[model samples]
Target: MHGPDRDGELWRRSRVAVSPDGDVVGAISVLRNPSHSGRFSVSLEVRPDHRRQGIGTALIEVARGLRPEPLPLSAKAHTTDLAAMALLQAVGGRIYQQCPGRRPDPTSPEIRSWAGIQAVPSGVRLDPLNGVTADALAVAWVAQYLWSHEAWSPVTSPDTLAQRLREGLADLDPATSTGAWIGDELVATSLVLREPDGAVTLVAETIRRDQPDGVRLVAAALARCMTLLGDAAVTNVLIDGHESDLHLAPVLATLPPTPAEPLLLVEIP
Candidate 1:
């Protein structure tokens, strides 16, 4: 095992297992979880030929030995990856949350179903963001983000969280971003982002969960955003969100069910 190095307010380190021939067979990295203090996130990978050889367990033990806090360490495994899940569970890991990913077809009938809802419940109106910057919607983003992740991540710093949200928002494609508004208050935002890899993601969220029409309104806004994306000649928008999100789940479910590499967040105590 190697020594940890400082990274921001946390420490990160990687350890590897090598065979007598000096070929690396397995490797693991441990880093502090930014969202939850005192907890570490680990990633492990072992060569295919090295299965059931205890290399994975040995790497985890190395991570456990370098615990920076009392909380249990965390890792993510795809729900379908039984072996990885079992390995972590064998070492006392438990699934705490799920983050599902999908590439929603913009032309799907379900998505098109929302196109007719120009004004959900007949009052909420949709408007394009034009060139609005993310900082302009700080409050709504913070509320929506925190609420979506509340199950496993608690707010650590309001300012820091807001800053992080804005950073992500920086990639916001205003031309395709839409806001659902009731009069002057912006209740929901459907964002389209083009990542550094050129892959696009659609993230629609509502700060009006307290309102009866919040979810529907956001759904309509998402459709409106997609329509604009189509107009701009952009295709292949991906979406990944908390599986249990009231605002995200139903909208994602509108698409046909397909095999997806959904991840389960696991924690080992």
Candidate 2:
């Protein structure tokens, strides 16, 4: 069992079971989302010897008790983790989005060039996120909202969310990170990370739902980042939430197919 201090960091209580001789054999942690209305993610780990027992199911039941009713939950399962997948499925998870591992074809110059072409709407403008301002913070929050509705893991607090954004922005090379706005209201955002071998990855991209021509706004923002990265071969851009939103699906369909990494969302009644 995790002690109080460990439990605090996990954002919820945890339960552990030990063998008769006092060997720790299984553990599970439940976390509540500090930002969203009511959501949680439960993670479990069990020792090999404890397998085939009802321990995993019991741990989930305990975690479920920590939260209120009408809970919407989700879990990320590795493609190879058959046991974990089975457990999550048994608990009522359904695969929603898949993250496909892909390699950029060197012959696909057209695709790279397409990503670099900015199609900015007449009045919208793109800019780098100024982390020190309230406006930037608002934009970041909206971006986080978009993320929360997508396949992202739950966060425990506003402070944690702020810290994550700060760290993420600081780690970004200015030339590859950017945000967009119309007049003063932030509308779209996208980020790119360049690898040592001259490959680039599109880390996260979002456009406020209220924005007019949101999809175009996001595409323009991505194009700006791609241009700034300047010929750093984009290996593959894994666009999340594409399957849930048709707008995103069309955008992703433009790219080549590769290995799919499934993301499962669950809700227990």
Candidate 3:
């Protein structure tokens, strides 16, 4: 066993377990979340051959002992992973949110049907997020994100969001990323992202809670986003939604249902 070594710059600590033969078997890491001060996000993995042993429990104990104060740990796992959920449960972890993960066909008729639909609420204009300053884009994203009613949504500030956008801008599909505006005010956005794993995703939301046509604006942006999927050469696009999502959920429901799994975010307090 080794480490709970601190990386001060990143505000993280990690531990690793190695077998007597010098083979690494498992590892765990805890990172401080920028949005939630003092709280930590945890990631753990154990080699299959080392499973059923006490390694996982021992690691959790070590994680708790890293600091004198109690550690509030947050972790994400698929509900299909029975063993992982069991371990989380053993450590007093409770489900904080349930995120629905779906992989809908990008070439579906429903998607194609929205290709030519330009009907949006009166006075609203649809446009791609090209040439938009990161600061401006982040402000718009944060506004909608806060009012999204998504259980798994994290609290974010404009600075953090801007930095994130700058870092991931290379993967952002500008041609397919659409925004809704009433004159100069951005009301909604649907961003298409190409993941490092080669998967694509469409994230759409309404930014203004008070805007009566918020949902319509989001739907229109998403519709435009779907229509441009072909231009991006995307065959599969994943979307994450919360059951209680105020606007995004309703827009997703209009599409044909696809196979989805429940992704759980667990917290240990």
Best by the TM-score measure: 1
Error of model 3, residue 165, in angstroms: 3.1
- Give the per-residue lDDT digits (tens) of candidate 1, residues 153-192: 6666667778777888778777777888888878888877
Question: How far off is model 1, as Cα RMSD?
Answer: 2.8
Best by lDDT: 1
lDDT of the candidates, in the order given: 0.75, 0.59, 0.74
By summed lDDT, which 10 consecutive residues of candidate 2 come out lowest? 1-10
**After superposition, candidate 1 runs with Cα above 4 Å error:** 1-4, 108-110, 117-119, 232-235
Give the Å error, residue 142, model 3: 3.0
- Which ranges in model 2 have alpha carbons more than 4 Å from their true place? 1-11, 66-74, 94-111, 122-124, 127-140, 143-168, 183-185, 192-207, 227-242, 245-249, 258-260
TM-score on alpha carbons, each prediction = 0.87, 0.69, 0.85
TM-score of 2: 0.69
Order of quality (TM-score): 1, 3, 2
- Model 2, 1-269: lDDT tens digits are 24452333346666787889999889876665455435666677889978878888777777777754457654566667789878877776676545543333323555556665647888887787544264465456556455545443334356655655555444345555677777876666666544465444554445544556766776777666655554555445434443544234445556544445554455543
